[model samples]
Target: MRQRIILDVDTGVDDSLALLYLLASPDAEIAGIASTAGNVPAAQVAINNLAWLELARAPEIEVALGAADPLEIPLRTTEDTHGPHGVGYAELPTPIRRISTRSAAQMWVDLVRRHPGELVGLCTGPLTNLALALREEPDLPRLLRRLVIMGGAFNHPGNTTPTTEWNIHVDPEAAKVVFDAFSFAPPDRRPIVCALDITESIEMRPTHLIRLAERAGSHPIETVSPADPPEARSVASNPIIRHLTDAVRFYFDFHDGYDLGYLAHMHDPFAAAVALDPALARTRPATVDIELEGALTRATTVADWAGIWGRPPNADIVVGTDPVRFFDRMIARIGDHARALYPGQPVGDPVTRLR
Candidate 1:
């Protein structure tokens, strides 16, 4: 059975890669894409959505814009990671399509209501949209099949701050609201929270990019451009890919600065991968909570169920990753999908061999 999913993303580089993987995968059907303010503004997020649809050639799928800021504080954008455009440095032809009339939060609520127990919600950004939807439609959670979120820092040091992950840090109140609403139950009703430590540990080395490029061929560039031919569109039309490509290029620059060229963390893609194929991810039951109040620890997520820490585990936490095996599997799957989609394209030698 194909998994029916609605991707709520900030269109970060890794988020773009995840979108690409979904477009290539055979197990899922993207019901819609809802954007929220995070890596970029809500407006740009809407633009990124159009770019993605143009690239993926799947404009038929619904795309809706969501919240511009948190329910409380003013919005904060991440130009350092995703670039000024929120998609990174990669440029493409202007998106030809306009956004759906409905807002992302409304679309989410409606989708869940209509689908009823068949929709898997994949959220890879700030929790604003999800929180708003939950607040508006109290019954939405009961209708959802499952929810996969990519945010929070369990045991590891935070990426955005010393104690919090970016998505949660952006809006801990929103995070708390959503987590409070959703309940996880092992293999069935669990809300999979892919944290920073786990995802950062899963790196997309130069070898993987080369493999992706090889498989993707020249289609990626053309696909991302709104003016690209219809046949060239697919997952590449995903703004997530455009942003990812931009981020990869930026990462390359950072790598060069530090003499570590082309190495990039899988981050959002890894989280999406776990949601797409949980069998590939290793997880354990642990209590998790978002720390709403603390001068130094604001927005931090505490995960320590029993002997680990006094804090009870609120949600199932993803802690470990089989890096070597998982990367190989991801590369294999992406390559196969790329080849099938863009045949006769040259899969050049990997820029750097996988370690």
Candidate 2:
């Protein structure tokens, strides 16, 4: 059975991979994509979504524009971390497809209502759009079959701040609204939280990229390094491999700059995998909440694992996963899909849109 899913993302480099992962998965059906402001502006996010879909030769999927800013605070984007356009050095062709006339919030409400208990929600960006959708349809937590969120940092040092994760830090108010609203969901349906604690461990090294390219049957099996010149880009033989090489190369550069080695913490794609098969991750039930008032801990995610507050668990926080298993699965699916799309390909053909 194909699982129907709606992806809400900021389209960061990792988010791009997550989208491609879903596109490659045989049993996953992308119902729609919501572009939220985070890694870049909402407009560019929407463009990234369309461009990726076009690159993957995927079926027409509805793309919707989300709010320009968060619920309360001004928008904050991580261009330095994800590159100016959110896709690193890879230049995707402009998509001919247009966005849906409806807003992202409306799209969520309509999709869930239309599918009832058949839809699964996957969010890989700030909670802004989901927060907005909740305002119009408060019963969203009950309508969907499951929800998987790639945000928050529990017991892990924050990547954005000493105590905050990037997505939640972008809009703490929106995060709070989402966590609180979903508190009413049934325990079995608690949102699966893929916090930084587990996601940062799903690292993507240069070797993994090489494996992916090799599996795709792309010639020259590209490899990258921190010692390489900053301006270097991929000149791989396959179009998808070339683009992915360039995109992830930028990510590798960013991590090396932070002394985290030339590897990327693939946060979103892991969440996408968990959305497809929860067995990919081991989770713990917890009463999750967002911190909005702390001067040093604002946007921090606090999980009460021991029922200290006596509240029902609103989230199933991911705690463990075998990184090897995930990397193998990713390489197999994406590499096979790319090979089928552009078998024995040459260097990226003068970038152009599909007819």
Candidate 3:
């Protein structure tokens, strides 16, 4: 049976790729998508989700809008990291599909109850929506088949503050609630935490984009460079290739600006892959908690890796993975799916497709 999943995203550039990764994978069956506040505002995130589904011509999937703000703190969005609208330089068309009437929290609660013991929850954004859902349905931790979260920095340099990751930093209270609630989960069902320590290693350089475009048989195979004008857009023949190229290019530029290099971290998509196939991750079981009271370390993920806490491990923290294998899988699946959607030059002679 295909693994069933509900994705909660902030629709950041990486989050957009995560959605595409799930759609491209034959083994995944996306039940719904929740748009939460983080990379951009919740409303804009919902719009991006709808726009992407339309652009991909994907099967109809419910897109639910999450709370306008975080659980406690004021909403914080990183438009500089992601573009103004969260999707970087990609300008996807507005979708005709309407957002679901159910709020993101309601949608989460409803879907998990409907597919108890079968629905996998994947959160590539803040834990706001899931925390709200947990409040509505206290048994969610037991009902979910599994949960994979892309947040935290755990032993790695923080992407937000000196010690906090973006997702957790945005809503530490929500993150705390999630970690505390899932403590009772069985060993097999503990949340798989894909923190920055591992995700930073899943970097996507400009060459990876070229490989993806070429794999999809898109003509004028793309090349992104640090010297390219920031306003330059992709002209790849395939629509998917064009948008992804544009999006990843912006991400590349963002990283380079921070002296991190001209490559983007595939954080969300890596977590998405582990959600479907846990074997993709190498995890270390730990009692995980959020630092809510720290003056300078608030929102930091605290992993008791040495059993000093005397509490059961609530999270299986990913510490290692082979990034090369992941990029290979990403290129193959997304490339094939894109080619199928917009058939381009055949295997060798990159031409154009006309229905």
Candidate 4:
């Protein structure tokens, strides 16, 4: 049976890749998509959702826009990472599809209630929407199949600062709320968070982008096309390539001196992967606490209770991943999706897909 899932995302460049992976994976039955305010404004986040879904040609999946801002703090935007349009420097084709009138938090709560214990919440952005849903319906903890969050950095240093990932740093209060809400919930009721350290280890390098480009070939990319050879004549174009290329390029330029530049870590995708295949990850049972009031450590997640303040490790921390197996699975899946969506190129064999 396909795992029923509701993806809570911000539709950033990475989020777009995660969405593509979710829709392409046969194991997941994507119930819907909920947008949040993090990488960009909530409005644009909603707009970007339509473009991405249209590109993936998965209109059957509902797209709902969530919280416009954090629960307590003022809205914060990240133009540096996602750019002004919220998808790096690339411009995706504008999708005419309208966003669901229902609020994101509402969609999330209603879906969970509708599905009862069958829905898995894959959150890849700030925790505001989840927190809001929990606030509106405190009993939701018992109904969810699970909560797989993509945020936080335990032993590893944070990306945004010395101690905070962008998602958590965007809204520490919201993170605190979500973490605290399920901290003491029964094992079956709590959420599982995939931390940054584990996620950063799974990457899609520039070679991967080149692989996608090679699949696209000389044919223009933007619209849907039928399956064919790598050098086959084009039926339509694929738009995701240009934007994704620019995003990867921007990412590469930003990490010029670091090894991270070789590949862009699909942090959100790996988190979603854990939800689909728990075997991809080895997790440690512990309490997770988000520090909110710390003068300097605010928005940081701590697993153990030391001298610092953090929520109890209510959620399991993913510490290990089989890099070879993980990469093989991911490349195969992504390569298939790229071929299916764009058509042409090497459809089989990851080893020769890029060549």
Candidate 5:
């Protein structure tokens, strides 16, 4: 049974990677994509989403635009992290199709309502769209089969701030709303948070990129200009892998600044993987709260790991992952997709085969 899923994203580098991973997964079926404001503005996020779908040749997936700003705070975009256009060095052709007429919040409500207990909600951005959906449909927590989110930093230092992760930090108010809403639901139905503790464990190095490129065969990277015709833009050599390679180079450079070496953590992809197969990571139940008033700890996710809070566990927080097996699955799925795209080309083995 293919897992039905709706992806909500800010369309940054890692978010784009997550989209590709889903497109490749045989067990997952993307119902739609909802663009939100996080790593970039909602409009740019929509543009990135449309361009990616076009590049993937996935015209069936519809995209809808969400919030332009957080519930209370002004929108903050991380163009420094993801290049000016959200995707790094690689420039995607202008999308021929427009976004869905329905807003992201409306799409979320409609899809879940239509699918009932079959929809899995995967969010890789700020919680604004989900929060808004909850406002429209209060029973959203119970309606979803599961909600997998890529955010929060429990016991580890954050990439955005000392206390808060980027997604939660961008809109703590919306995070608070989501956490509070889910607290009232059953533990099994609550959100499965792929926090930094687990996501930061899986890293992709240059060797992995080389393996991906090799699987894509010896295709020359071509740059498309605005004057180029649609067919010319579409016939690029291994466009998906080439774009991924080009964008990841920027991310690798960013990680180098933090002395994290030449590898970048597979944050969003791990979340998407866990969503497809819950057994990929080990999770523990915990009561999560977003700090709203702390001067230094605002937006921080407070997990009651030791039951000090005395409140029942409201969320399942990922704590562990087998990096080797995870990478194997990732590489295999990517290799499979690359082979499907270029059937005549011989795709060599991935960096590592599934164990």
Candidate 6:
């Protein structure tokens, strides 16, 4: 049976990729998409969400705009990372579809209530929407089949600050509320956190992007001639691969600046993958708390890995993943979707598909 799921996103580069990954997966039944403010304004996030669904030809799924800012903190956006439109270098045409009138928190409450004990909530952005839903309906934690979050850096250094990951840091209070909501839930109901510790381990270098692009029958390099404009080489007949390659180029550029060798971490996609198939990564139970006020430690996800805190475990933290296998699965599913979308097109290499 296909997993009924809702994606909570900020619609940035990685978030967009996560949407694509889930849309391409046969096991995922995307019930809805809830947009939050993190990578850009909530409005832009909603736009990106609708655009992606339209591109994937999955307009039947609902899309809703969430919080414009965190519960108490001033909103901060990461336009530098995701570009002005929150989709990096790719430019998506405006979608004709309209967002649902219901708020994101309302959508969450309605969807879970409609499919009690059968819906997975995959959050790849700030926890504001989830927290709001929890406040409105206290039983949300128990209703969800599972919750998977792509935030925090329990054992690894943070990508935003020395001790805070971007998503949680964007809204610590919201994160705290969501974590506390699950604190008393059963182990199986607690949130599964795909933190930076494991996500950072699965890096997609240029070669991987090249392979994905090739699979879509798009040229990896736009142009080899120095005289030709850089944009000329990015033209691809496959819209899906074209958009993926263009958006990834911006991400690759950002990582290159960090001397990471043009590699982008598969953070949100890993979380989405785990939401669809929990066995993709190994997890351990741990008590998690978000630091609300510590000057330099605010928004840090403190995992009680040693059991000294005496607090009940609130989250299952992912610690390991098989990069090769994970990528193989992801690429194959994406290729399958592309092929299904355009039957006669030359979908690139079949090696990954064979797996």
For all predicted structures, in order, the TM-scores are 0.84, 0.96, 0.97, 0.86, 0.91, 0.94
lDDT of 3 by residue, 108-225 (tens): 9999899899999999999999999999998999999999999999888999998999999999999999999989878888999999999999999988987888888887776888
Per-residue C-alpha lDDT of model 6 across residues 121-231, encoded as one tens digit per residue? 999999999999999888998999999999999879999999899999999999999999999898889899999999888887656765565555543233211232325
Candidate ranking (lDDT, best to worst): 3, 2, 6, 5, 4, 1
The true-versus-predicted C-alpha distance at residue 332 of model 4, in Å, is 1.9
How big is the positional error of residue 216 in model 6, measured in Å on the Cα after superposition? Answer: 3.0
Q: Looking at model 3, which ten-residue stretch has the lowest summed lDDT?
A: 346-355
Which lDDT values do the candidates have, in the order given? 0.71, 0.91, 0.92, 0.74, 0.83, 0.84
- Give the runs in model 6 whose Cα sits over 4 Å from its true position: 218-233, 347-355
lDDT tens digits, residues 1-355, model 5? Answer: 8999999999899898889899989899999899999998999999999998888777488899998999999988888888788876667889987999999999999998998889999999999999999999989888899999999999899989997899999999999899889988887798899998878888988667665656556244233222322222222247777678667767766777678877778899889999999999788999999999998899999998888988888899998889888877777787568767765654443342111
- Candidate 4, after superposition: displacement of residue 325 in Å? 2.5
**Tell me, what's the RMSD of every candidate?**
6.1, 3.8, 2.7, 5.8, 5.6, 3.7
Residue by residue across 1-355, what tens digits does model 2's lDDT show?
A: 8899999999989999999999999999999999999999999999999999998899999999999999998999999999999999888998999999999999999999998899999999998999999999999999999999999999999999998999999999999999999899988778999999999999999989888887887766667887667577676666788889888989989998999988999999999999999999999999999888898999999999999999999999999999999999999999999999988654333332111
User: Any runs in candidate 1 off by more than 4 Å, and if so which?
Assistant: 183-187, 217-246, 254-262, 307-313, 336-343, 346-355
TM-score-wise, the better of 2 and 6 is 2
What is the C-alpha lDDT profile of model 1 across 2-76, one tens digit per residue? 898889888866677677667766787889888888988888887877776666565377778988789888888
Query: What number of clashing residue pairs does each candidate have, in the order they appear?
Result: 16, 0, 2, 16, 0, 1
| 137 Cα displacement, candidate 5 (Å) | 0.7
Clashing pairs in 6: 222-233
The lDDT leader among the candidates is: 3
Who is ahead in lDDT, 5 or 6?
6
Error of 5 at 75 (Å): 0.9
TM-score of 2: 0.96
Cα lDDT, model 5, residue 131: 93
Model 6: ten consecutive residues of lowest lDDT:
221-230
Candidate 3 lDDT: 0.92
| Candidate 2 least-lDDT 10 residues | 346-355
Q: What RMSD value applies to candidate 2?
A: 3.8
